[model samples]
Target: MKKKVLAAILAAAMAMACLAGCSSSSEEASSDAAETEEAAETEEAAEDAEAAGEETAETAPAADGELIRVGIINNDPNESGYRTANDADMKAMFTEENGYDASFAYSLKNDEQITAAQKFIQDEVDFLLLSAADTSGWDSVLQDAQNAGIGVILFDRTIDASEDLYLASIVSDMEQEGQTAVDWLESQGLEEYNIIHIQGVMGSAAQQGRTGALDAKVAESDNWNLVTQQTAEWNSEKAQQIVQSVIDAGTEFNVIYAENDDMAKGAVAALDKANISHGVGKDVIIMGFDCNKWALQELLDQNWNYDGQCNPFQASYIDEVIKKVVNGEEITEKTIILEEKGFDATTITAEDVEKYGI
Candidate 1:
């Protein structure tokens, strides 16, 4: 009886061990299958992510295989007709169709322009094109751009920053423009010159250059007198008010030197309203800068005595510079000066108005 019980217990123990082994094997197989499936899903996800990245890169803007990225900073487009034309020219040149991924920022304030530059730097732009509203306070931001391997080109106006900070400067000679206008005025040989000087935004290169020549001339000469000098901020209405105030005060002035055509138009409007004669060989000698078409027409008709030419179409020059930069070629000129001239009512022809007018 003892042998029988021992044999039964041994059989039952072996059977239980075999059952446990089978269950362990089944669990191991299930775990292995699950791990393989997880690995496959992870690899598919990685591949999809890589493909998306490539697609994004392919769709991005480039000049040829890769688009050159440019950030342009300019003044308010509506500030004046010249500015409008300038902005339009910039827009036309810096386009994706022309092989550039371009971004633009516009402001009349210096601080705001600096902020925009910082943003463009953070975005890692390849180049920065600037037409600064103010000449001062650009050093630090331009230095930051230089540190980041970004090239800078100055257009329209120059900042007070170091030349090393920029690759090239394509600008009008503002001081020369002013001097030319003043020279023309001097040639008029007015016996007693009393002037109403209307300036653009204060501290701007245009204003400083234009105002400096006239101011110096007036200070040196006994005949040339500034009846009133004020900033019209490139606004016609403000210019009109400035002139109206001078007229209301019975301040006798023979010359109106407006910094821009819009302001000149405003000053003329005030003169017209006051029943004052102006223009060629009139009571007041009207002088203005930035030869807008209408203003040049005014000159051609002898309705304005003088208009100074400030060339606004500088995009082509800028584009060529950028191409040379991209190709790692030497820029022969550090400062590219645009050729400009002034027009007189007496000599300005219809062709001059059509060809030179902005």
Candidate 2:
């Protein structure tokens, strides 16, 4: 009986040890499986993160180093020949090859331009280059740019903002351009000036500056008569309509003072259709701004009386200013006015057209 009990106890002990060994093996297997799953999950997360980093690198404007990001806000390239040349000049200068990562925004309206400026500021561009459509409504946006630590450069046109708002202004002296044209008109010494003043986009810097001198002159001079004053908005067709309406009304006008070459061309088209002789010593004198090659050619051929030079090639000056700012150099000249002149039909030479034409 004692042998029987001892054997039974040994058998039970063996069974218990086997059960404990089985449990230990099962726990080890579970741990190994869990470790493998965790490692796979970690690897997948790393791969996803790496892919995201690559995408960001691809989409970013600047490279690893030395790329100057610029945001150019300008008028529509198709707004006029002058604008087209201006846009082309900016594009040519601010290129990847030229060490700039430039982005462009265009609008003829002031509100739209301000919106673009806000976007560029939000984008954190290194610089903001502007050719404002209108002179007003810029103080707030420019101040915002200043607050954001972005450099502001004015080109082609001026704004009503304070000088402190912009780092540099490389622009045309528009009022001077108007004064030059008016001075030339005064030099003509017409006995009785009956003028059809065809203007550009209303409230624009160009329109205001160009018109201000003429308006003052007309207001002061007793002999000067404004047959009609109208805005063409820089559209040739609108200018034609304005002239045609005057013609139909039989308004006696001896001068067509168009604010731009395209508008002047339109005015001349009306004169041609009416068989009204124009050009040197003709029935009317044609005056225009923006020395487009064709417009200057018109002056050279004695078809247009005068063409004012607006100097659309401001890229070199702007590039230099940008370089100075980047290098932490002081900008001595706050406002750099481009040198410009007016060409008379009687004196404009082919060489002059070749040299000064846009």
Candidate 3:
């Protein structure tokens, strides 16, 4: 009976060890199951968050089937012929039919533009399209735009802002345009380079770039002499008065490098009033920018010496960029430069005028 009791006690101890072992295994299994469930939940949360982000990006403009809001700030449409084309292009692209609700503000003052941009930011526009009146004084506004998650696009001109602040820029290289004009001027084999440089709005991107090249070129050359340098503020009347003032002063300027066609026309008016013949082989050499249909005709008719092309139809390109941004696609090109050509009165043809005249 004692031997039976000892065997029974040993069996009881064995049963207790088995139960402890099973209990430990069950606890480990329960912990493992809990860990697995936690990992699955975390993964599902991440997926849902990612999907929500994608949906927010995809449906950015508004609720289903609503048009996106855009703010367009540009130099006044009355600023120049180029501006007229620019304004028209924007008007055509940012239409209700094109799935946009766009508001516009036009000014030649940078501070005014900054104010408009701030108002647009306050209004919560999805996109801000800029043809800045000036290049500087845009960092703060652009930073605010980044903060608000509004996409900014530059057209016709560029500005001093971080690449992160803007979506893309569609512009003509103003410096290159100036260089092309200067190179053509050099090719003319003129005896003297007495230039009357009538500039556009001071401190503007257009004025700066165009002036930079010519200024550099003049510095390197000994023959080039600027008889009078003045800003016309891109006004025909102001430009006319400028030329008239120069004429009254009796400054012996032979070449008129007017910044725009209107100013060039104004200079021509002054020359016409003075009976100073201008054109091919004339006393005054006339040059202008913005291939306005009428201006190009002047080149074709051999009435104007030269006219440089400044492309203004950047609205379509900006529209495409906005679409890509809205669709969550990557834009590889940060700056898209438009191709332009210069026309000479000597070489310009009717076909050339028709094909390229803006």
Among all candidates shown, the one with the greatest lDDT: 1
**Candidate 3 weakest ten by summed lDDT:** 54-63
Per-residue lDDT of model 2, residues 129-175, tens digit only: 99998888999899999999999999988788899999999988889
lDDT of 3 by residue, 1-358 (tens): 7976676566556545554654565455556657887764654454444344333333333233468899999999986667887898889777775668999999999999999999999999999999898788999999999899999999888888888889999999988888888888888888889998989989866788778878998899999988888999877788888889889988788899988888899989988898888999888889998888889998877779999888887876787688788779999999999877888999888987776676
Ranking by lDDT: 1, 2, 3
Kindly give the stretch of ten consecutive residues in candidate 1 with the minimal lDDT sum. 54-63
lDDT of 1 by residue, 123-215 (tens): 999999999988899999999999999999999888787899999999999899999999999999999999999999998788999999999
lDDT of the structure predicted as candidate 2: 0.86
TM-score of 1: 0.74
TM-score of each: 0.74, 0.74, 0.72
Decide which is better by TM-score, 1 or 3. Answer: 1
Q: With candidate 2 superimposed using the best TM-score fit, by how many Å does residue 239's alpha carbon deviate from the native?
A: 2.4
Which scores higher on lDDT, 1 or 2?
A: 1
Please identify which of the two predictions, 1 or 3, would achieve the higher lDDT against the true structure: 1
Candidate 3's TM-score reads 0.72
Error of 1 at 299 (Å): 1.2
lDDT measured at residue 171 in model 1 versus the true structure, 0 to 100: 93
CA shift of 133, model 1, Å: 3.7
